[model samples]
Target: MKAFLASLVVALVVAVGAAWLLETTYQSTAADAYATNGARVGDPGHNLVGTDWYSSRS
Candidate 1:
């Protein structure tokens, strides 16, 4: 019926709006963090070029 259709549309709109808001908030926060911390967020890889068990298979 009309009520169901209207509710579906309202729900879709709310979902889309919520997704947009979350994305925007995340982007803003990430930008602020990057501006302050300059992309050195975590430690570098430890054994990337070493002869470990997996690397020695070749």
Candidate 2:
């Protein structure tokens, strides 16, 4: 029982960390995509995933 509890705690921590890492990675990719396109992304106020990148406007 003690071992099970310990394992559960470890699993929870791992899950939380993995989720955070994935979120950051995804957001970065979205920002990069917008930047590569070179058209200003309008405000939805916040990034859906990654950094908020303002593209060059004509």
Candidate 3:
């Protein structure tokens, strides 16, 4: 049981490391993809969470 727990911990560590590596390698590509998708940074598109969150044009 102890050996199995140790192996599980090692595997989790390796998986997390691989995920971090991939994210680092593709960081720019991911950002470019998102930017190209018209999602524009800093623009979350107001959907009105409440009436008080917006002001009337009239």
Order the candidates by lDDT, highest first — what do you get? 2, 3, 1
lDDT of 2 at 42: 61
Per-model C-alpha RMSD = 8.3, 10.8, 9.1
Q: Per-residue alpha-carbon lDDT of model 2 for 1-58, expressed as tens digits?
A: 9999999999999999999988977555444568655767665446465565566895
- Most TM-score-accurate candidate: 1
lDDT against the true structure, per candidate, is 0.69, 0.74, 0.72
Measured with C-alpha atoms, the lDDT of residue 16 in candidate 2 is 97
What's the true lDDT of residue 51 in model 3? Answer: 50
Displacement of the residue 1 alpha carbon in candidate 1, Å: 0.3
| Candidate 2 stretches greater than 4 Å from native | 26-58
TM-score of 1: 0.46
Give the alpha carbon lDDT tens digit for every residue of 1-58 in model 3: 9999999999999999999997888556434567765765544445438656665775
Candidate 3 residue spans exceeding 4 A from truth: 26-58
Clashing pairs in 1: none
For model 3, how big is the CA root-mean-square deviation?
9.1
lDDT of 1 by residue, 8-36 (tens): 99999999999998897755543356654
lDDT of 3 at 33: 60
Return the TM-score for each candidate structure.
0.46, 0.45, 0.44
Residue 24's C-alpha lDDT in candidate 2?
A: 77
